[model samples]
Target chain A: MTNTMTTRRKSNLTRGQLPKYTPWVVVAAAVVLAAAIMTLVGFSAFGWGVLAAILFTVGLTGISAAVEGARQAKDKLATCLVFGSFLIALLPLISVIWTVLVNGIPGLTFDFLFYSMNGVTGQFDDAAAAGEAPVVGGVYHAIVGTLLMTLWATLISVPVGLLAAVYLVEYSEGGRLAKAITFFVDVMTGIPSIVAGLFAVAFFAVVFGPGTKTGIVAAVALSVLMIPVVVRSTEEMLRIVPNELREASYALGVRKWRTITKVVIPTAISGIASGVTLAIARVVGETAPILVTAGFATSINFNVFSGWMASLPTFIYTQIITPTSPSNPDPSAQRAWAAALLLIILVMLLNLAARLIARFFAPKTGR
Target chain B: MSKQTSRAGDRIFSTTALMAGVLILVVLFSVAVFLLIQALPAFFADPSEITGGEGFWSYIWPIIVGTVIAAAIALILATPVALGVALFISHYAPRRLSQGLGYVIDLLAAIPSVIYGVWGITFLAVQLEPMYEWLAEYAGWIPIFAGPASATGKTMLTAGIVLAVMILPIITSISREIFLQTPKLHEEAALALGATRWEMIRMTVIPFGRPGVISAVMLGLGRALGETMAVALVLSTGPLILSLIQTGNSTIAAEIALNYPEAYGLRLAELIAAGLLLFIITLAVNMVARWVITRNKDFSGANA
Candidate 1:
């Protein structure tokens, strides 16, 4: 008993009064109790279930407080809460990727990738009766449509937004016109995707009479969304360009316009490129605007000036909402999921490419 | 003479750039004006014939109320978690862990809004129904969570949750940058003073980063206010209502999207009016965000 007392004293001296463990013990016992109670009473009552979960967590913390010290246990409780919130944030994202991968994998066969949706039935009975391979559909048309529309949107938005940024940062000198442009661009930045679609529809309707829908119209609508992001990001990049560079170019007898075009733009090109790419990525996922302006078509239309074209977003929407083969929806859903997966892949690639472009083109500082 | 001609050419180039900038502005103003002008006739027309009604208040009041309630709920629920994540990334985590976590958080931002809607419908709806029922039964005193459940699983609460998820990444990322830039000297001073870590964060770090946090919230609010896909996907079509459990009430943008295709006569015009209202709210929110961001000098990580 004397030796044990001495040893305890030594431990207390070394470890600052041997942290209290009673709270932690209590917490543990409470948690076990809560869990047992919860199992006894099923989770059908969400209120009671959530309450039990909370009690369980709290009980664990109390147990830690008893085993460890109150302070250390509090810290542990905080760590758990932070980690829990992080997991809560992550749950949806992980579930999405997992679901898409699992559902999309079945439709990712070589034949599925190569074939078109020309003669596919979404019927399970048909598939069973045939004693053959499952029917297939292709995203080739959607892939092409997405590419064409994105290209057109890029063409329309880049020059306009770039020039506008130039005017705002370089020439306008915070003039009233520049401020007005700034205010409006800020407004446009917040414009709903659907409203942009409506604007494009109305604009095209005015130009091509009442009922006008095509890929070009969709491109215009997307530009309405894209331009604001491009303008904002480019303006920010250009504003960050060192004034010394523009002055150096001017000192070398370069005109103001020449200085802006050659030196200022080049200096900020890397950021501008990434910004423009992000803008594209931003709008490429847009469904409502495309649905409003482009309308849907099952068949591929190469020409933007034609009757109808199907972008990937619209295709996904139609496939999910109104399956042509309603008797069985698995195939249609498979196609939609594949297209959705493809869209996510495309955006991810664009983002990666943007990063690469930024890194490669960013101006290097020399010693 | 050649020099003078060249001067004219320089003038033309700058002039063209200026024209392009102004043209963009005009296009924006025109969009706002066009929507309001188209929708005005419906307001002046007979009330009995109008979809929502002719009284200016009747036409817009329901949607406005619904939009505000959902946006507010989303903003409230998301802001704290976003700030916590931002703090974790900026202050708490180790360097490599923070970097990896940052990328994961940004990945959340990259997922399309429509996918969230799809997930909400297929997965979350079935899972959350019991919780919803409980809220209705227990928290019915709070009118927001009190309403009849819909057959379609599209509830205002669901829409609000999706909007929260949509804005979470934006808020977290922006606030992370802000929190990361908090003045080093202040934090070091608090540490040297033998203050506890939480106390230090509360007293020194937050005060310094407050404006940036506010700006981040404002930016998130703007996105939430204008969010179309998640709202359009989640909302059922009906007059806007206050009940979170009820599924049919729509926001301004969602209403326009649903009604625009088949709308005719004055109905189309009223939809435009609804669009106008959304435009105005979004413009105000963006302006406030921009103003806050511009005024907050320490927010840019210049010192860092």
Candidate 2:
């Protein structure tokens, strides 16, 4: 028996196992083979990379199946596919950011941020394109319009959204009315931004008379989109507030509303605030709704209740669609890219702020 | 006196909260009502007077088909890739890297649609023109690839691709959350049976995640259907055609956005009517998605 066992051990059960560095070796081989193939055909970097990845995957899977077995090969194939999908999904994101940065930075000058397109004309863009002058128009009025409209939208949405959330969590108790509201709110979240614009237009056209476009109308349109987001986020936060806190308030003879106001809201305030900021970020870049509701203006308009207004997104759209100089669209395209950069900056800052607020002000739970 | 004041305060507070909740329902109701009222004129108007010299239905039909084709392409391209991405984050990725990767994906969501529009029109279209020409030359026998291919590459296929990118994050995040919530016991049992990692996942995680994945894809479909600015900016406008590689075919949202600025009277009502159609389509899609979620509420971690 001892002699037989010794002979078996000498033969080794690890005969079919792959070396630890097999994948690395396979990758190197695949790269070299892919480059040779690419040279034979017409070579492109993207094509070379694709060939290398395919060769690496096939080579490793085939070798594994031949030696280790089919199951291991399947596992390896799955891993490659999942990782490859992630890399492919990331390509568009990287390209978009790089493109925006490369094209946007040069157009982002002091005059572009501080001046409006009010007095600028085709002649200026024409001259700028001819290399005889600097680009003259700016996004100042658009910036003001965006801020004012977003501010008013927040004012309109927050109170309504907050109260609706309060009712849903504290008062509703899954009643019929509450269920209806909940369902409709979910439905509301799916409303197209442009449809919301149309709703605002249809509503105002009847009451305020047709063809009345203003910053206030744009604000109303934005609020329709913003309110549902705020309500959903606030409701989630409120529901997570520990029931013990509310019970403790009740045990101390506190009123229901008072307990909600004083205890529950305080505990969830950080989440609600961050959620509101996110909602703002979502609406701040809306172009279609604002375009249909407020129309566009070249000059700054301070009063939201009167006059057509221009937001950052509409400014970008109009610039691209109807260039200040049709013959030379480069200047107009430059302004659009610059405004896009500014809008992206504003959105990223808001997102960062929301993250910071959520992290720093989260309710303490003893570790 | 304190009792009286407390009672009054409760009354006021509760009433205000109730009113706010009711207002949401009212707003939704009014949106449908107002749209219908405005759209009545277009329906009643003479067919000859409409933009196409036909009725509203004829004018709207092609764009409706265009919208569906674009959204279908988006869904088909996005669903598999999104599922793969979700699996990577939930199962294959290192724990430390997964959270950061998830955040990076969410950043894709936060970029506004207009930026996507600009990127699609200026960058993607220009880059893909060559590929379209190549496909037209080599794959021309295939009906969809049969193109006197677009010179500028502003085609339905390009818009669909942009839409695919736009909705990828939504589907990925939702599927990731559901994939993470697969029961630990089931996974361990599969592994204990000497299953490979992929087999174990197929037996446990995928089965558990199937409904959740379906609902997530549906929600992504709803978003893609309703998405406006990207399609508006990316696709070149013309009458609808069968080939996706051509520069023609307009979506309902894009039609409204491109024309509403200069349109007036019946033209305005026609656009509003089209908006109503879009609203109904999205509403139905979202409702079905929600119904699926609620039906599977017991098994899903979606609500949590």
Candidate 3:
């Protein structure tokens, strides 16, 4: 020990002794080594991960124990655990997307996108079940129904939601009514999508008939779900606008109403648009509400005010659970996966568009 | 558009706003009242009037238990990973990557629930069966893990896990936002005192964000309570209640979705009654969450 200490650098002893690339080199070796050994035992990525994790932890701890000592080794363990938590959290997201794509891709096609299930029956679907023919029918009608109902729901929700938000932001002084409105809106935000459907059904059952089903009823149900989201997001956007701008408009001698319309709204319109888009995305995939209120129809119904309508969510649901053919559910399962894929794509686009709109419309702070 | 002419327009617009506010309240009251009226038959029905001689208590006990257990299990499974993701995105990710990671979370949130249902039934359920059997085989001493050992994957445990995956992005996004809002001074002070990166976060960030995180968890819990299709699809219809790892028990939302189409007379009323219960439970949770937020002027973000 005395002879080695004479040759050892004092600077290295006081500072750090391990190489900077030590962690990476050890981690790589651990992973590759664990993978090979696990393959010999049984091919499981989970087993490989567990083995590699143990190797990484013990190996790093041991190496640091020799060089940097105990405190540094403990720090490394904590850091690894933090990183491992992140990876664990990310696992489901990756798995869900990968599984959806792998299973969903085979179900999507030109025929699937364009054609409807107008005349398709169980016997007609049997060919697809045999893996000998392309899947029968498509989600075209459901897509149309989703579009029209969402459009109407948007139209209904936007006006009411916007007006209330305007009141909350521009008019109300936190009076009793306003306070009640705000509290109830928070409560309303938690109402399950199914409960809204029940309300719509009950409303129709009492007012119109016992068994009325229409696209409009579905619209009403969706509107119930959309209003709170719109109000919350729009309210947040409105509050963040600079008060000096509103004051500047007032200083210019603009009427109170004109100031709100010309200056305040134009300033916040982009966020409001994005908020509305997000609210739409939030509800478009709701299955239970539409299943209860609209009832599934294979044929396209253009009008929202009358008759049963099928949306993508319900279409996927009925196809999977009840199936077009009781004897062969493969075709139905395929269609379900396809419709799910379509819905996910639509939602993804809406989210992307919302972000773009929000970015574009945000007040330019360049000045 | 002159001031004088627009006075009437302004008045009308303000009145419309008031009307809209009134409409929201009206809608809430009506949902409660109408559901109550529909559910009255189920509450009042005699044994002679009942289907299968099932009273409201017997009909609803399993569902109530199912709802509580599924949501509780989902919350348990999701909270740790959610907190980890929140911490990572808020404190640890590279500055250039953090914003992109947040966008990824939003993308996860935007994916539809029905798609999750289909995937759970189609893939996850099948993949999870072996693990369930193994748990029962080795860890049967644990009450929740102990099962009748059917080895079927469409059990309450699967429902809980699927619900956890479905709710993950939400709790993470909210908690991440809360952590991001931690004042820099606190974090800097901790780090200046010789704390490691993780230690600084534990000392400053989580304590400051606790209320917000709690509310976020409550919000996730509310979502899990009402989640219908995924639970319906993944949880096999059954009557057992205690052994969630086994193939039995269904939540209230799934119960209504599964039974509503075939229900008649008192049966339909009972389903509506169940729906009402779900609405009340979620509403209570949301109210508490909102109260927590509003209790803190600094955290509420409401200008008012």
On DockQ, who's better, 2 or 3? Answer: 2
For model 2, the DockQ equals 0.81
lDDT of 2 by residue, A187-262 (tens): 7988899999999999999999999899998999999999999999999999999999999999999888898899
Residue-level lDDT for A38 in candidate 3: 91
lDDT of 2 by residue, B1-304 (tens): 9978888888899999999999999998899999999999999899998889999899999999999999999999999899999999999999999999998888888888998999999999999999999999999899888879999999999999999999999899989998999988889999999898999999999999998899899889889998999999999989988878888899999999999999999999999999999999999998898788767976565445
lDDT of 3: 0.85
Error of 1 at A129 (Å): 11
Local accuracy of candidate 3 as per-residue lDDT tens digits, A1-367: 7865786756545566677889999999899989989989988987798799888988887888778767677767766766676777667678778887777798899988888889999987788777777777998899999999999999999999988888888899878888888888987888899999999888888889777889999999999999999988888888887999999998987776778778887889999999999999999999999988998899978988888899999999999889889999988888888788888889888888898999987877668
lDDT of 3 by residue, B1-304 (tens): 5656878878887888889888988998999888888888888989556655767877788788889899999999989878888787888889899898878766767778888888888888888888888888899888878866655588888889989987788799989988888888889999899776767877888888889899999999999999999999999978855776787887999999998877777888888889989988998998998888767745543232
| Clashes within 3 Å, all models in order | 11, 0, 0
DockQ-based class of model 2:
high
Scored by DockQ, the top model is 2
Output the better candidate (1/2) by DockQ.
Answer: 2
> How should the candidates be ordered by DockQ, best one leading?
2, 3, 1
DockQ of candidate 3 (2 decimals): 0.67
TM-score of each model, in listed order:
0.87, 0.97, 0.93
Q: Which has the higher DockQ value, candidate number 1 or candidate number 3?
A: 3
Ranked by lDDT, top first? 2, 3, 1
